[model samples]
Target: MFAGAAPLAAQFPSDSSEPLAHARELLRETPLVDGHNDLPWRVRELAAGDFDSLDIAVHQDSLHTDIPRLREGLVGAQFFVSYVPADLIGNGAARFALMQMDLIRRMVERYPETFVFVTTADGIESAHEAGKIAALTGLEGGHAIEGSLDVLRTFYDLGARYMTLTHWASHAWADAATDEPRHNGLSPFGELVVREMNRLGMLVDLSHVSDSTMMDAMRISEAPVIYSHSSARALDNHPRNVPDPILRRLSENDGIVMVNYSPTFISQEVRDWAVTRDSLVDSLRQAFTIVDVTAPDSMVVDTAGLRQAVAGWTETNPAPRAHLEQVADHIDHLAQVAGIDHVGFGSDYDGIDAIPQGLEDVSTFPAIVAELLRRGYSDEDVRKLLGQNFLRVLRGAEAVAERLQQEMDPIVATIPP
Candidate 1:
């Protein structure tokens, strides 16, 4: 399709009229890469509804995914994640993996030209080249292999480019970020998994692993890695958020920390309030020793307005402009802490319920750029945060992948848990 092939000129508002035009023009022309998206499962639900036809007539704001929204969002390239429950590990992982892959394949078959099933880096470029949004695959948990290295290889062959070692759940071979006992970093077999994944050319994602696990896995892996969707703990002290020291090391190793845009991660106040609220409520329960008494208050969230919603919720939320502004700040901060070359955008859109108000979905990317510009981010730095930095790390991960595959047959990689 030609550039003019897009109905963007006729179907939507123009750059001149839109308030966010400056950033929009830059983001529209640049490649906006989001590290993780749960659209495969969403596509599964939408396919039942015929996503090509969004008939969520009863509730249009169901989920933050669909073709019409994608078009409206104007995202250039994306990774549709195949996330399965980690409990499905051991023997059933491959079944879940096949089901998700089948869903992606069906999506392609249902909308051939609108989506491109890309395998190679060139294929990704070409898909976007053809005016189609490039849809690549990412497996959210390593448990998708069911303890079989052969199954892991099959997933790589089927076009999975990245795999998170663990999910929020523990795996037989690895520990997880939540509730599980530690596994002394990667198990011996888990280390083999990392070596094999390096061989397979798949990028190892670390968005949901424990800190101890993260350090240990980093030591064994030969290639650069990515925390596909994590924030700066320095800003918000959540375990999910990577700290400065880790960020510094990731920078030194040529890895990346794609900034996640979930409201909880983006706003410290929100996290604190949530934590405080829970703690306070828990205290009340123990005080009364009764079933507890915090129901109506917990349910009463003032979504009546974004301002009201954020007033009590804005922990580190700079103005939305500052949100974008700090996004640049984070880019610069991570670069300062990690290195100028390592920060990237891994906005976790759709997977979360809320985001920075003005910047709700992928389409609002231009607003971020506009904010960056207002804060004096040159076009050069703008390009790097938008996608270039992530691409560089991806290329490096791919390089390491090829080297490992030649050295070992099964690609075993450890992930977060």
Candidate 2:
């Protein structure tokens, strides 16, 4: 599957065409390294694992990402998320995770010319040199490992470089950002998981874990930790956003905080609206008997029926829109607090229901670059925010793994109920 030789954005004109041109020029030198994108899960939902149905080599309006859009965005590397819903943690979660991983591998296999499978920073640069997007795997949710160190190691073997310690729900061993604390941070097993991840050179992601968990991991992890997709909680006050205290710790730990683009995380006004909107949706779901909207099973969510049921509610209670500037504000705040070296982009594209106005799809990354440039961010600082920061974190993790293997034996600690 050969893609067009010309970049997609080359043909289109943006409002800030001058800055957009500058952004394109910068990307030519330093391509954007996105921390997370959920196109794999979207494919699972839309095509039921059938690549032929939603071939990314061609354009797909239903998705926020595609091969063409990625090229347009000048994405040097992407960590495609192999996400499993938290509800499935106990019931064959590990099996589902394998399936997700297989989908990502198949994606790379199917489009070799456009994407190159990569696990290391060097691999990313090599792929970029070949004019191909470096495809990396990131497992979202620790439940994917199902409480076994062997499973965690197996995922790393399968090309997953990072795993979010928890998702929306708390794991048996770890606490989640949104869920009530069960372990008061991380249980002994959770700490072991972090240590083992350190040993294996897998980046321990703190995106969905609780604040206490973030502190605990920072205190324990020999290697740097990453908030794969989070914003500044000081700005938005969401549980999913990182607090200032954690941002300060990231500088000492040598970690990076990839700011999330979710409207809920970016704007407090949007978050308030979302809360009301979600409450209304929940009420409608109960009234109309729709179960598991986010479930892997396509049959679990009656998409059309739910839409019709909630049509009036949606019309009356519209979702507030966030702007690209808000997204940059998050990056700015995170940089001011965490240092520019610790800030990067993680759009969470295809995973979130809506995006900010100027950043509607993958092709709009240049707009963000333009925004940062307008804010007096130097070309060098912008480059670090775009990709260099993440690359540094990746290299740091690899180095820690090498040193840990030399010094400490493999930890085999267990959780106690």
Candidate 3:
């Protein structure tokens, strides 16, 4: 997005006097509290839930995340994602969700020296003070609850502090950003879900929900909501990105939008290319051996054929490129529309295969902060963007939870057909 910006690693000077260096120093103090990272799901995919297969305690070139890389990035805390393929909605979503949570808990248990399990905002701070990476859990889709309030509460009790209302597909209660509007917005059950989330102190995530769903949840939620891994739609017009109006509404609701680093969500050209590619994949599904990729967990296609075909399509239609500056651009747009207090980092790492040009892995966060410095963002504002805004939102949710448990009754009402 910067006309001809240098590589991310080169953006900052090694010298301590430079502003970039100053930004790095600030990160050392507060550290980046990333809203989302999908290393757990990546482990599930690669090792079939075998925790011993991957040694994250050391550097893992296979992953976008590793201890060395996270330390280099100065990531103080992370919300490790428990993402199940949306197609598992009716089949084994709840079970899958539990398995993913179990994996995260096991990961923390295995690497106690590197990761400290954190559930509350206070715990996050305490872990940081103790010089450990605070590990928190977040469920990626509402389907993980299987439309049961009891299930939702159980997930909360299991250390999941936030749950995105939808993923790439719609569920019984909420609509997804990428799916055709089935509920138009939050169905009656969806509204009940939001209210229950508020009472339970769980942060209601709106990243994959449709705009109307976002509005509906914002209207009913007593606590602040979060766009855990979304960018600005006004910049790229992708459904997965948040619209400017919603950013405005976010400010009023006292929430934050963690900018997504996914190339399609950040670049209009890439989004356009993706639309065409998806159509081709659909056609392939019809012509060749079936693999309901729409339901990733259940996909049973000609893997060799589909992979080769998709690779060919990519070769023919080159995917558009995106850079960290564009990432900064989205951050700037969010701050401009929603105010600086409402913007933060939520890179969907490991969850996505494509990386923006300059943002290769966890180690590259300094370059992003350095670019923000080049854009003349004050050090304080940059710090807030890095992690403070998210921390504030976390603390706010804790306070809301306390007030809610005392002031309000849990919604046990169900949606009527």
- Candidate 2 stretches with Cα past 4 Å from truth are 1-16, 281-310, 413-417
C-alpha RMSD of candidate 2: 6.8
The lDDT, on a scale of 0 to 1, for candidate 2 is: 0.88
Superposition TM-score, candidate 1 onto the true structure:
0.79
lDDT of 3 by residue, 1-417 (tens): 232234333554444336557667878888588999999999998888786788887788789998889988888899998997899988899899999999999989988888999998888789888889999999999998888888889999999999999999987889998898888999988888888898898999999999899999999987889999999999999988988878888877899999899999998888888899999998896566764668866656686788799999889888888888899889889989999999999999998889999899998888888778766676678778887888888888888888889987766654321
Query: Which model, 2 or 3, shows the larger lDDT?
Result: 2
Pick the lDDT winner.
2
Which 10-residue span in candidate 2 carries the lowest summed lDDT?
1-10
> What's every prediction's RMSD, in angstroms?
8.3, 6.8, 5.1
lDDT of 1 by residue, 1-417 (tens): 112223333433433344356566666676667788776766556565254554322224666655666666666678878878767766577687788887777676777667888765666667766878778888888778877677778898899988888888877677777646557667777777777777777887888887777887788878788888888877767777788878878865788888887756766766776676556545444443332247644433322343443444445543232255445555556766876567777777667766666666665667766655554555566667777777787778778877765665654443432
Question: Per-prediction TM-score, please?
Answer: 0.79, 0.90, 0.90
Q: Which residue pairs overlap in candidate 3's backbone?
A: none
lDDT of each: 0.69, 0.88, 0.86
Q: What's the lDDT for candidate 3?
A: 0.86
